[model samples]
Target: MKHQPHDAPPGDPDSALAGEAEGYLLARAHHDQARREAEDLCARMPWLTAAQAEDVARHYTRKRIDLTRQMLLSTVERASQLRQEYETRYAALRRDLLKLHAAGVCAALICLGGAGALASLLSR
Candidate 1:
């Protein structure tokens, strides 16, 4: 028997939406943190000694930026994975819908053909 739409065994709408929303929020937060860190690095650079100031400032900014990039990358990767999963599900649903439509068409044709045959036999 074909599975019913309402009877989704798993990956229901609420859970999926929640997961996506969470990922988006995380990415946003990570981006904000990174921006703040960059600003701090710039503001503090002047106080640093000339001997190793540039290097130290660069290191601080680089570390924060790298971590932010990583966080955003992970968020993007998760979102990509979610999109792929949804695409796959939609493809399967489309296939099933087409099959159902074809079956209905075949049944109608069969019924008409049978009726025509019966009428011919009666006329004979």
Candidate 2:
């Protein structure tokens, strides 16, 4: 039910939360860098030279997008792994608690029985 970022790389919810992985931020930075690079190239490439500015821009943009997709996938997979681990640990703790509770109930019943028997013997 927890909401995650729609923009996050395919799998890295943890990286978005932790902000620790260089890989997770690569896509955003890459896109910015590509824009800057394309701008610089456009400024230098004279119109007289008839450079393919649009093609160059598209190529860099696509590369940045692809890298971002890769990062997203990695993040998502790690999050899923963490989720599974938590589930396993939670299940174990629940089992242990149930066992302890059962033991306590048994001990209480035994103590009550002993007390009742003692009282009956004293009455005789």
**How much lDDT does each candidate structure score?**
0.74, 0.76
| Model 2, TM vs. native | 0.61
> Candidate 1 residues 23-105, lDDT tens each?
67886786667667655766676765665665665676668768767886798789889999999999999999999999999
Evaluate residue 76 in candidate 1 and report its C-alpha lDDT on the 0 to 100 scale: 78
Assess the local accuracy of residue 43 in candidate 1 as a C-alpha lDDT between 0 and 100: 65
Q: How many clashes does each candidate structure show, in the order listed?
A: 0, 8
Q: Where does the lowest 10-residue lDDT sum fall in candidate 1?
A: 1-10
**Tens-place lDDT digits, model 2, residues 40-103:** 8766876723357777767767876777678877888898999999999999999999999999
- Those runs of model 1 whose alpha carbons end farther than 4 Å from true positions after fitting are 1-56
The best candidate by lDDT is 2
